[model samples]
Every structure is written in structure tokens, then in C-alpha cells.
Target: MGKATGFLEYERQGGVLVQEKQRIKNYNEFHEYLSEEEQQIQASRCMNCGVPFCQFGMEIMGMASGCPLHNLIPEWNDLIYKGNWELAYNRLKKTNSFPEFTSRVCPALCEAACTCGLNGDSVSVRENEHAIIEKAYKEGFAKVNIPNIKTGKKIAIIGSGPAGLAAADQLNQRGHSVTVFERDDRPGGLLMYGIPNMKLEKDIIYRKIDIMKEEGVEFKLSQNIGKDKKASEILKEFDSVILACGAKNPRDIKAAGRDAKGIYFAVDFLTSSTKALLKVRQKDKKTDNLAKADGFIDSKGKKVIVIGGGDTGNDCVATCIRHGAKSVTQLEMMPKAPEKRAQDNPWPQWPKVCKTDYGQEEAKAVFGSDPRVYQTTVKEFIKNEKGELKAVKCVNLEFSKDEKTGKNLMKEVAGSEKILDCDLLLIAAGFLGSEEYVAKAFGVELDEKTNVSTQKGRYATNVKKVFTAGDMHRGQSLVVWAILEGRECARQVDEYLMGYTNLSPQ
Candidate 1:
């Protein structure tokens, strides 16, 4: 809770974002923070409501309403309001293992469900968290905590993603020797590459990884389990194993010329961009010179089309803009959401409203119009004689609810098809599930959605002494949920290993 009258007296203030026009020139984090005093005032706006829904992580109307990690928003906000910077950081770290990652990338579910938002602007809980975490790093409070007593138990985590890293951190703190195996050369699965550098710099991830290493968590890079290393070997080496490899099998666009050379998955494009950017940074090359990089899918001076209207698609738009795209267009299957909250979509539930992400903003700033075209999808990918992508045949669609099952059905609008010139096509249509090879290698069962199958409300799989969590277990989800799953899974593994656990699941 915050000051009794603070909500009425203060207004919420957010971190200042660099103008899109200037930020698109390079791939770097563009958010500028507020001073300590200003952030405290914003934190003071957290009302002392009897029912603090901001911390109540729950699913309502088939969508997440609040912070899935159940972060101690009120406690941290109160501490920040009182200028107890260190204590605020402590309280924040108690629940959220990595506030730095979430503060920069998370959509701020806590703010959306804040009680203050009922009548006025929500409390700047996300900004307060950012301030606390950054201050913790600056003041050296974010130090490594090597466990005093090392348990004989050893855990082999199969991924270095948020879930895997969180599980490793918790289990390591509980004195279990933890080793995280990553297929990629670098750690931080999605954080490392899938997300672009502008949203989250690579150095931020490496900074936390260094601290984890100091805390006694081992990271084995370039170790692709089930391929390079057998799963049986890991099971024999470690007392227990947890699979946190994220859902990475991207869903493909079904259209003619799908095999065109210029088409790429959104993750692949983003990964390449980040990898090239990091390489250039290491060589002291100009940051904006990613087009000259050898490995990346260069979008400079090329007409680009991105399919899918989600966060990843927006990221592709922004990345293409940063690459100095000749033109950019985004297609969405669903109709455009209302600008503001709908009457049926009440507070305390995830608001189903239109969100103009940073990438879309940058596209508009550069192109003089929003790149998104709602109710549209690619009907065909037209390739030239050279077998490279040349254009896309797109069509508008309409949706209607069925009478019996109450399910929405989509139908193409007659005579709405149109052709647009496109040199590059990026499909950000989301993922199907975890890759099959990993599941088969581990001898784990998969559900209909291709996610690792488990009993209802359980992290344990069919295999004995083996567990799964995060997107690999629950399908595609947020980083916060992945961390929460990892923490909870670590607790389960700890109990199974030691017959009891003192670790907190929350």
C-alpha cells in the first residue's frame, strides 16, 4: 500500500521514450528513466485499496489480468514511495528474479489491473520496478549469493531461457548444483536472440548471466541436447533434470511459393539481426551498419511484408525500419480492436484493446502511416522466375460466430484480393510448440498442441526424475509466466530430490 492521500495528490509518470524518428537510426534501448524523486511520486500513486488486484495474478475471460509472476507490487511501491531504495529492491527480488528484463519488455499487466486505473491513470508500478532494479545494480546490491551448503544433488536444466534460468537460480540457491545447457552459443534463450536489441540489449542479459555464474550456476553453451549430447547421458550425470527449452517451432504461412528464398521466420530474422549487431559491436563497427553483416537477412532498400499483427510482427516491422526498408506492410487475420476498452471488457480483466507497439510507432513515424492492415492475410506468395519472393497476393477476411459451439469462423471476403510488391516476407504467425526432436530425444510425450504433455496442473512429465516447465510445457506465453513456471518447477524438483523443500514457489 502507498500513502493514503497520494493517489489523489499525484499523477502517474512513465519513463521517457526516445522519439521514434531518432531511435530508428540504430538498434539500442531507447527508454530514458525518470529521476529518483519523480519515480517516488509516481510510486506514491498506488492507492491503498482493500482489494489490490495489481498483485493478484489470475486468468479472467481467457486472458491474464495481472502480473503472472505475482510480483510484490504494493510492497515494492510502498518502499519506493518512502524512498527506501534498497529495501524496495530486496522486496522486488523476492518475487521477480529479474526485474531488469521485465521492466524493459513486459507489457505491465500490474498497471493494467491497478485499482487507480478505475478512475484515473494507473500507478507507474513498472517504472518504479525499473528504478529499483537499476538502482540495485548501481549500488552493488545485486550481488551473487553463493549457497553456503552444497547439496549432493545435481540438476541439469535443458534450456537457458527465462524458465530454465529461473529454475537454475532457485535450485542453486537451495544448494543444489545446477547446470543449464543451451543449444545456442550464447545464454538467455529468447532474451538472447529472439527479441531484438532495441527492446533489450544483449549486454543486459550477459550482465545477469555473469552474476549467476558467480552465484555458482553453471552454463554450458552450444550443447544441443538430443542432438549433440544425448538425453540419457544428462539423466545419468544429474540427479534430476528439468526441460525448459521454449516453444520454437514457428507456424508457417500456407500459401503458394512458401519455399521462396526471401521468406523467413520472424524469430530467425530477429536472431540474425541481433547476432549481426553483436558481431559488429564486438568489431567496433558502426551500429547502423547491420546491412553489411554477412549472416543477417538484410532488409535495406527492400519492400518488406510481415504476416501477423502480434508483438513479434511489430518487432519485425521495427527491425525492417531500422534496416532502412523501402516500404513495410503488416497483415493481420483478426479485425482491429477498439482504440479504448470495450464495455464487455471490464477492469480487473486483461483489456482486449488495440495496442500500438514501439515498432508500429516507428513505422508510422517513418512511413507516415501505420503499417498494419487488419482483417487481411496472405493468400499467395508470388515468386519470380528466379524463385525469389517478388510479391504477395493478399485478401481481406470476415469473422462470424457459430450458432451451436459459439466459435468464431473466418471467411474470405469475395473480390477483396489484391497484390502488393514484396522483396522480403517475414512470418510472425507464432509457434506451434516445442520442436519434436527434443521431445523424442528425451522420450517425453507431447500434447495435441505439440507442447510437452503433463498431467493437469503438474510440471512433471511421464518420465521419472524428469520435469518440464515454461512454454515447452504450457505452449507460447509471456516471460513472466516462464519465470514463474521455472520457480515452481524448481520447488517440485527440490521436493522430489530432498523429500522436502524450503523454496518459495511464488
Candidate 2:
């Protein structure tokens, strides 16, 4: 470490954020990075613990703790502390294929179980990581690394999200002739659309896609493998196929009047907004909030009601605010989590706590209050004469444990019903599983949860020479887990193709 006592000497500094009012006006990322020297100081705060729990990927109490990619946290932190930006990037890339994307979108699981965070604030590992990767991109160290030898083995990957992209990067670098099929007009499926641009700008995704193209990965856009092209045809062409389509079957509300107009899935709304922005930016190069809302449903001047209190719900709140919504509200069926970790949640386990994310912050800033209401849910939708959403009837929820079964049962509180005016109702209640179309097209079996069936603890599917990774197999999860699944799945695919492979597991 650059300074042995740096953790004690310096206070933890996270990425600075743009003022909420100002940031809500634009769809750009709000967090600003610290300077080089300040970032070095933040990196120096890494304790370099003998255990280095930050890099320890482990499942505790049904939730993953620490970095799933098992990044070389201590090594990279030391490099950053010493001002060796290139070396830090090198160490980071040893495990992760795309740091730039993860730096922006990931929830910083590494920081939660950090040794420094046991009592005090955690080392700013996430921001330090951003600084490292951004420096790499700016200083020209992140150039295209074309594979020296061509394996001449052809591989087809379906989907172009983080998992698919990571697998393509690894396999292509190993000299495999990899072709990625994306159903969207562009690559980076959810990264391009599901996630709001303010969280992860579209250009950052295109930049990485550009690099992948230069390194010999062919990206076929607007091709739905099972629909536009036949899965059987791809199976005949490629030696092996990997499916990385994310769990995108959104969980929709079935309350009365659900079919009313002015309601949409969170992903659909986000996708439409991004598509409009892309269309406008490409045509006129304007960054202002002006875009064609022809087919896409908009929330401008509409009372918006969002169901679900997760990150996606928060994103909806922020997006609605930016769209000039008259008012906004988010509904959570469950009781609010504790502000601090409970006694049962000890160190090294994922903490269940209340943390206001950027979207919630933006919502609070714009509407003069937080949009989230704990222990509440939409009971039914109210509609107008034209069958459009006019408002929603909500009811307060009370959870009680069963005396004998020990199961938490939800009970609707009597006389606790209220109706809120709403026109745009966006369901942000997470996903069920991968859409059945692609999995069914490949003749692969699905698990009870409707995810692609894979061998226990493995990525191989029921069909021979076919594999599934990411949310498509693992259910809805964070981006970092998708990257890990992709890397490990690629290694297994390489082994299957080359008899014995040289690809490193993440």
C-alpha cells in the first residue's frame, strides 16, 4: 500500500453528485468523479487486509456478498494508490471484461462487505474503480486487443446484454469466431434500454461495442434468433450456442382496469424513452429533453403511479420527474427495511437496509417529497370514459406472522383505502423470468421459475452444445453477477470446443 496508515489519515470520499434540481433537468449521469489525487487517496484507504473480503465472492444467508467477479481488489487498490493507472487497469481486467459499464451501474457490493466497512465507512472502491477505468479509456491504454491466433471455431451467442458481451469478449480474445445476435436495433440489451440513460449513458455502451467489433466479434443487430432467424439454422452454423437473453418477462399488475391505456411496463417505458432520445440525437444532435413521443407513452404533466419499491421503481420516479410529471408516487407492498442492519445481519452478509438511491433523491428534489410509500400497494386501477387510466385505488398492507406456520401473511387493513389521481401507471415490479419464446425456440427445458434450465451449478442447458447464462438462467439479478456467469460460462464453452481450454474463469 502507498501509505500504511492511509485509512486512518484520510476520510472516505465517494463520487460527488450534481445538485438534485439541476440533475433532474437532464438525462445525463449525475455522479462526478474525484480528482486523480483524491482518488489515489481513496484507493490508499484500502486496508489490504490479509483476507481481503472485498474480493471474496460468497453466498451468505441466501444473498451474495462482496464482488461476484472476484476482482483483484487489493492489488488494484495498491496500484491506484501508487498512481499506476495502467497497472490498476491491467489488474482489474484480469477478472472483469468491462469495468466502465460496471463502474456506473453496479450497486457496489464490494464496498458493503469491505474490511474497512466493518465499523467505519468503506473504502471508495467503486469510485476508485471508475477513476481507474476512465483513466484507461482516456490515456489510450484500453485499445482493442486483437487476438494473435485464430481458433477458427465458430460460436453463436444470443442476446447482447452484459453477460453476452462478457462471454463474447472472452471467447473472441481466445481466437474464437464469435457472432452475437441482438434482437434490438443496437447491442447492450437492458443496458441500452431498461436502465435509464442517466444511470448508464448510451454512448458508453456503444463505445464498448465499437471495441468489441474492432477485436473481431460480429454483432448482428435486429435479429431475434428464434423469430427472425431460426434457432435450428444457427445450431447448424455454429459449433456451440450460448443464450444470454436476460429475464425480461416483466411482472405485470392484474388489478381491475389493468388493460386501461396510459399504463406500461417499466422496461417498455424506459426503452421507448431511450429510443426517442437516440432517434433525436442522431438526427439533430440535440441533448435537451426534446424527443418524439409519437408511439411511446409519456408522463409529461401526468400524475404517475409506480408499483414496486425497488431500483427499477426509483428509476421510474426519476424518469417521470425528468418527463415533467405533475406528481409522482411509488408503492411498496412490504414494510420498509430498517435504516441500519439488524442484529441478525452480521458482517459479511448482504445488509438489508433503507438507502435512498439517485432516483429517489431526484424525485424528492423535484416533488418536494419522497415518492416511496412503505406498506402500500395498488388494489385496482381507476379509468375514465375512454378506458384510460385516470387514477388508482390503493390500500394499506399489514403483514402478520402465522402462529403455527411461521409464514408472513399479508392482510389488507380495513378502512385504509385511498384513491390517488394517476394517468401514467408504470409497473416497476421486477421480472418473472426470461421470455419463453427464445427458450422454447431452442427446445430447451425451463425450470419451475420459467428460467432456462441448466445443470446444477453449471451453465449447460438441456440441449447438447448449448449453454445459458445471466438472468436468463439465474433469474433477475445485478449486472456484476451477469458478468461472472458470462466469464465462467465462456470458460466451460471453451473447454467443450477445444477438448481442454486455456480460458481463465472469472
Candidate 3:
């Protein structure tokens, strides 16, 4: 703790953003970093609770209630408060390998479980993290930590996402030679493609990867193990293999006209858009595979309907708006949450409520109306003569608990069916599990949901010398969880490879 009266003296202050109107014009990061003085003021607000539930990382009511990485939140907050940024950066790096990525994109579970949040606001832990890590970069403190001795063990990590990266970082620190294989053209799997550039700039990812490269981690891009590259070769070559392939198989909508040409998976759309942006930046004149001017699905001058109102759906809305669509609408099956926390929702758990995300704000600003349609769903698709999706047939729903089963379900109101004119339809229904090719190729067992089946707390697969982590084992989750899984999984791999390990979870 920096000062006993620090919490009382300062209130929480989050990072600011660029104007919504200006930010929507291009695919770039919009968040403005807090000034050094402002970051210190926010850091001083940490109460440094005795219990410190923020780092507990427990499962409360079947949901993650705190930082899964169990980050040293209070220590870093105190460090920031005292203007000891290098120390704060060191503490952050002890557990998390990529604070810059998490600081920008993570949901900040630590703040939700903050002790100060019991009565009032929580400390800006996420913003303070962003400040510390960026400060490290500026002050030349962030660099490659080359191990003094080599263990002569070799490890292969399948997938270059957060989990794989973290595992590589720790395992390499143990003096084992590690190589990461990614099917995509670049490293940073989902971070490089699945997420939009505006949320996380690609250069930031490349910068860290450059350092990792210098630290002796080899990255092989466009190498699809078990497909283009043989799993047998990998198994024969490396002493151990860790599968960190993220959950990429998207959950799709299977309604009438689902095979129509205009419909697309949210991941596909986002991935294509990012690829287009990267191509443009690379100045590759090859427009052969670029997303059309009408948007990923040609939303320009056409009505766009997005299904499933999560972060992916919001991204579609923002992307369409930027593409100059005539109109954009989103559908949500669940009822709209309240604006504030309800009486039943006590402190230290995620606030169950409605909050306008950045995309929605941009939509509202441009369209002069909130584009979300809660308690509604697309029943079917209406197609044109060319077999392209022209509109979506939707129905209003009433959410209520069933008397017989006592389960919440949606009931369609009579004569509530309506057709909304649309040209592009995006299904943002989330992901089921990791892709089947690599897992099946490696002969790894899977859970009922198709996730890599390893007992919780143990990341080892059935095959000896094989390990798994991130969405490959846990399904879709936050980046912080991926980092945690990666770090912990690295420890497990180190122990298996050398019969001993020194990687600390804390």
C-alpha cells in the first residue's frame, strides 16, 4: 500500500477515448493513454484490501469472479502510486507475459472483484497496467531475458495465440528450445486476426513478438501442423508438444436459407477485414481477395442485420457503419439487462447490467438511434432470385420462467413476425471449441463440447509429452485467462520435460 489515506484522497479514473465520430472512420486504436500524473492518481486509489479478493481467481456461482492469472494487483498499484514504474512493470511481467494486450482488451476482472467496489468505485487496475507496461517500453526496460544456460530440451507449441505465447515464454526461460507453429501468415493467432485492429493494434503484437524472437523462440508461420505439415514429423522431432490452438470453429445459425451467399460467420468477417487492412498497409496491390467495397458482405447501401448481440455482433455493426451501410440492426435472444446493478447482485461479482459498448455508441452517434433489438431473434432468412439473402424474418419474444420446469425460455408472441430488409447477415453466435483437424490429427481426446479434454488443473493430454492450453482446453474466454493457462501450462511442461521446474504462478 502506498498510503493509508490514498483511497480516500483519490477516485477512480479510467482511460479516455478518441471521439466516436473520428474513431469509426478508420481501423486503428482509439484509446488515449492516461497521463503519468493521472495514472498515479488512479493507482493511489487502490485500498489494498487485507483479503484482496481481486487475486483469488475463484469460481463464484460457476463464473470467473476475479483475475484468472491471479495478478499481483495491489503490489503493482502501490508501485504505480509511488512513481516506481519499473518495479510495477517487473511485478506485472512476473505473471503476465503480455500486459499491453491484456490492458487494451481484457475485461478487467480484477476491478470487478476489488474490495473498494463493495460500497463505491473500484481502482483502475487495467489502466494502471497499461501505463506501467507502456512506460517500460518507453524507458527501455522491456527486453529479451535470455537464459544463461541451455537445458538441451526442445518443445513445439501448436498455435501462436496468447496461451501458446505465454507457454513459450516460460518454457524458453527454463532454457528449453521452443518453436511456435501458426497456420496463419503471421503470429499472434487470434490477436492477429480474430480481434479488430482498432481494439488492439497489430504493431503492438509484432513488437513483443520481435523481442521473443530475439530471446530464441522460433516462429513458423503458414505452417498448418497435421495438415500441410505432418504431426508425425513434429512428434518425432520435439521432446514435447503443446497445443494452444484457440477455439475457432464458430457456432453458426441453422435456419431456413442459411446456405444463402450473403450470410457469414463473425470470425470470417472480422478475419477478412483485418486481412484487408493489413494488405492495404503492406501496400500489396493485389485486390484479388480483398473484402468488397460494400463491406465484408457488401453492406454498402444495403440494410445489414447482425444476429447475437455480443462483442462480435457489436463489431459487425461498427464495421458495417464504417462500410457506409444504409442501416444496421442487432438482435439478442436474451432480455435487456438493467442499466445499474440490481439489489440481488452484491459487490465483488461481475455487474449484471446493460452498458453501451464502443460500437453501439458509434452506431447511435451515426444513426441517431440505438441499433440493438433485445428480446428478439431472426426466425429465418428471405432470399432474392439470385439465392442471395435479401432480408431476415424475425419475431418478438417474451422472456419468462416456465411454471412446469422453472427454466427461463423465450415465448414468441402471436402475429409478431416481421421482415426486415437486409443485404448482409452476420451470425455472431460465439464459438464451440477448437478446430478438429489438429486435435484429431494428434489423436487427442475431446470433451462433449469438442474442447481438448484434459482434467482441470492438469493440461496434459492422453498422449505422453503432449500438452494443451487456452481456448483449446477451456473454450472461449478472456485474454487474461488465456495468459494464465499459458503460464501455468508452461510449468507443467517444464516439470514433465526436465523432472523439475522453477516457474512460479505468482
Q: lDDT by residue for model 1 over 16-128, one digit each (tens)?
A: 89999999989988999999999988888887568888888998989888898888888888999899999999888889988999998888999899988887899888888
Clashing pairs in 2: none
Q: Each prediction's TM-score against the native? A: 0.99, 0.98, 0.96
What lDDT would candidate 2 get against the real structure? 0.90
Per-residue lDDT tens digits of candidate 3, residues 227-329? 9999989999999999999999898887888888788888888887887777766765443233533244456687888898888888888887776789999
Greater-TM-score candidate between 1 and 2: 1
TM-score ranking from best candidate downward: 1, 2, 3
Which digits, one per residue and each the tens of the lDDT, describe model 2 over residues 5-28? 999999888777899999888888
Model 2 vs. true fold: TM: 0.98
Native RMSD of candidate 1 (Å):
1.0
**Ten consecutive residues with minimal summed lDDT in candidate 1?**
284-293
Model 1 Cα shift for residue 284 (angstroms): 0.5
* Candidate whose lDDT is highest: 1
- Candidate 3 C-alpha error for residue 66, in Å: 1.9
